[model samples]
Target: MTVLATPHPTGHPGYSETLPREPESAAVARRLVRTALAAWGLEEHIDDAMVVITELVSNAVEYGRLASIRVVVTRPAKHRVRLGVVDRSRTVPMMRTDSNGDRIRGRGLVLVDSLTERWGTDLHQWGKQVWGELKCEPPR
Candidate 1:
């Protein structure tokens, strides 16, 4: 697992980690998000960010079938944090709306839509990157 915690020139701080496509990697990604949020003095966003990252990471691990997945957490502005996951699979994620209220699966993007300020995916030659942004206020 290669982890990057370098300081960004913008002074907002950035972190990234590569995890294997294993079930345990989801927990690892959440931990990395907590650490990054703490370092940036943005602990208030921890819960939301963790949830978003967990969904993205789980999707990558379960659907991507790649050797490794990359997770990144960044604060692009004072009141915003972005969580993104890059995977080897090119299949874009679609938000499933017909969960029928009690299904045990297919609610990840619905949760994301309700929780995030904005979310979307980017497709590239290699694969796709899914990202979610949270508009958070600093801890009092």
Candidate 2:
């Protein structure tokens, strides 16, 4: 039962939640992301948000070494939406792909990078936050 908040400028809308570091957190994250984004009428972005949520949360659950997981959703004016996840691990962040013939278990951030307009990380107490942004607008 953790309440999360985000600072937004004008014309910004968002939602965030925190859950225990339990195995079911992933499922809960998926559901929460879908429900939150449904109001925006962006099912595609919602789906992507779900996937990104799973990956980010999974990483945190697996390696966060924290007590809970934090997730955020923001619609910053227009059709721009941002999804973020935070945990208690300060290992920075990295995205690896099988194409490099390296290990074979880290592709979460890779998918996020391909699907979101912008994605990055931020350091917090004991851990870091990973965020992905999606823009619903005409082609640039």
Candidate 3:
């Protein structure tokens, strides 16, 4: 159920790409984001964003199927950028914790939740979009 639709309209601009649901593509995407962030002078958040992107894509590749996954990067403005990875799956993801309250494997979301000011998933008539907003807060 891969789809072709216009991405969200933002002020700064954005780009979309259909990536093969594979581990290798995640690295390539990370590099792309890193480069873009560098140019945006937001390199500091690049790695964290990449990590979350990788996790999101990896999860989609592993669990979500029967649809093409799309990565939408929106540079709304300086000091902020939004990344969304969309899929066909309707299963809403969550930040799960184990019995001991020690998460060994489901930490992808825990990390994502902690890093960004806010993040969420988009599931509409089209598909599911996992998105996060990165704030360009300078280091203390």
Best by TM-score: 1
Runs in model 2 deviating more than 4 A are 2-13, 98-104, 137-140
TM-score of each: 0.89, 0.79, 0.79
Local accuracy of candidate 1 as per-residue lDDT tens digits, 1-140 = 66677564223238888888887998999999898788767788898888899888878888885799888888787778888999988999988888468777777888888889999999989999899998877777
Best by lDDT: 1
2 versus 3: better TM-score goes to: 2
Candidates ranked by lDDT, best first? 1, 2, 3
- Evaluated against the true structure, the overall lDDT of model 1 is 0.83
Q: What stretches of model 3 exceed 4 Å from their correct place? A: 1-13, 99-103, 137-140
- In order, what is each prediction's RMSD in angstroms? 2.1, 3.9, 4.7
